[model samples]
Target: MKRLSVSLSAIALIAAIPLLGGTPVLASLQKAGESIVQTLTRPQVKLNLGAEKQVVAQDQSGKEQVSWKSLEGNAVVQPGNILRYTVSSENAGDVPAKNLTVTQPIPQQMAYVLGSATNSNGAKMTYSIDNGKNFVENPTIQVKLANGKVETRPAPAEAYTHVRWRFGKSIDPTTGVKAAYEVKVK
Candidate 1:
């Protein structure tokens, strides 16, 4: 999945925006033994992203098991293969980073697996069908019925263009979170 790499640094910068308030500002002063000093700082979050291919193995009894193989270092990806992408973030600063959101764009020629997105940090997940322009918890589309009436229905997996996870709680110092989703190569 080398070809499917995302700009994780860019995402980290975006996640830091809310805390930076457009630019770094003087935060507060700390009193230490009759001395007061002003400290300017912001949350520093380290972000990482990786891709893996799902493998299904069968035993002699025909029992199926699932596993993932890292897609790094020249791994070959082919059509109809199922791939899982994981995004991880850790706060390395003293301050807690609030309102952290991670958005990952679906790689071209891949179809999302519905309901496959998961977050370990208890985040509110959303989907985008218009190339990340807009996102909703459940994306729907208008469909025309045989009776010439229009109906609203859940969007198809192929229509999914991006996945986003927004965390309600602040990420404390030295703590981390993870989010993952699956997609099928088209």
Candidate 2:
């Protein structure tokens, strides 16, 4: 009789789900679900490289004006041509994501454009010259002259190996973030 009463009580508790007022029986299950969701917060990131082609077209005023068309995907490029690299990150999970950092490697055959990197999400930007071994606001290297004099000089865009973006705030759920920079083909 006691076992039967205990079984009935368990069944009653399991069936007692209220939409307006939650009961103590569902608290454990609710917390477990929340913890699992928080632990599974995943962020998706993607990168794209493109070039802008100028087209001469007549405006409404009948004057020839230059307009740009973005060319993406595998396309033939030439030296001294400008290209844009964009990095996009999004929160694909139900929870917020923190400390999102996106890194891009500047191809050896290309030179990064100085003062062209910008962040739309207000992320902190840094550069690396030692193959991404170290990152800083401005990278420098020690130069040795013929007289054995050592001097530290700022690294040029051609010397840049990588670019990094450290997000300043947490990325909210379903929020999309983008950052981009320009470079020139060698």
lDDT of each: 0.90, 0.80
Off by over 4 Å in 1: 1-40
**Residue pairs in clash, model 1:** none
The true-versus-predicted C-alpha distance at residue 98 of model 2, in Å, is 0.4
Give the alpha carbon lDDT tens digit for every residue of 1-186 in model 2.
Answer: 999999999888777646225656478778899997767765543344445644568999999996656876776778877777777766776767778888899989999999888887899999998999999998888999999999999888899989999997888887868888878889
Which lDDT tens digits does candidate 1 get at residues 59-167? 8999999999998798898899999999999999878989999999998899999999999989999999999999999999999999999999999999999999999
Model 2 residue pairs with clashes: none
Q: Which 10 consecutive residues of model 1 have the lowest summed lDDT?
A: 29-38
Question: In lDDT terms, how accurate is model 1?
Answer: 0.90
What RMSD does each model have against the real structure? 18.1, 7.9
- On the 0 to 100 scale, the lDDT of residue 104 in model 1 is 98
